[model samples]
Target: MMRQKHNFVAGGIAAAALVALMGLAGCSTTAGVETTGKTSWDEQGARILEKNVVFNSSSLKGDLQIVDLRGVQAGDIMRAQATLRSRDKDTLQFQYRFDWYDAGGLEINSGAGSWKPLLLTGRETKTVQGVAPDPRAKEFKLKIREME
Candidate 1:
């Protein structure tokens, strides 16, 4: 009779642990679903074009800043331009790339972009431009990093 009681207690503990694990799993799954839904809605929002400028290197960010960013449609083709200003007192070498995205917020040419070199002198501002491969490019991301 005593052994039977012990067995029942062990079984109850096991069941409670299982329930706790399942609750945690359900919470994580719900969070995942919510994140996915929010991402989908953001991609489908009313913005025709989205643009972002990011500096990946800390030194580059300290020395330079993106002054202007704009995109325009030129006869059914998308064109992008950016102005970079150097705040340092010396010449700096940097590399930049423009990643194009479609209307659906999907990258046009994933892993197919080449980095272009740029030189900036102290207190100098320069404007760089890029033309999209096709008219389907409605969004763009500009990434700048320091070059060795």
Candidate 2:
């Protein structure tokens, strides 16, 4: 009787663990409840130029700026403005790219390639803009590269 009882308890615990593991396997990071109503630009976009960019904190001796980001939506047009400043009085040239991702955390390939070049004055700032090809995109990331 004692051995039978122990076997039954072990079986029950194993069953519970399997159920839990299955539930976790089905969970996803990107899939979730989405906004149904009209979404505003502020909710979708950010003034990263004004808030996030900072001047020289180290020996880099350069400043970064963002001017504007507009017309943002889950899967629509997006824009941004940026500026670069250098105290060394040297001209700076750089390249930039934008990437879009969906709610499921999957990257959407626009096939446009991913690099654009710009020239800036020692204390000048520039504006950049981008658009999403589809409406399913919910997140975006911007990448900057210094020209070699």
Which model scores highest in TM-score?
Answer: 1
State the displacement of the C-alpha of residue 100, model 1, in Å, after optimal TM-score superposition.
Answer: 0.2
lDDT of each: 0.69, 0.50
Model 1's alpha-carbon lDDT is: 0.69
Model 2 alpha-carbon drift over 4 Å, by segment: 1-63, 67-71, 74-88, 110-112
User: For every model shown, what is its TM-score relative to the native structure?
Assistant: 0.64, 0.48
State how far residue 6 of model 2 sits from its true place (Å): 90
lDDT: which candidate is best? Answer: 1
Location of the lowest summed lDDT over 10 successive residues in candidate 1: 30-39
Global fold similarity of model 2 (TM-score):
0.48
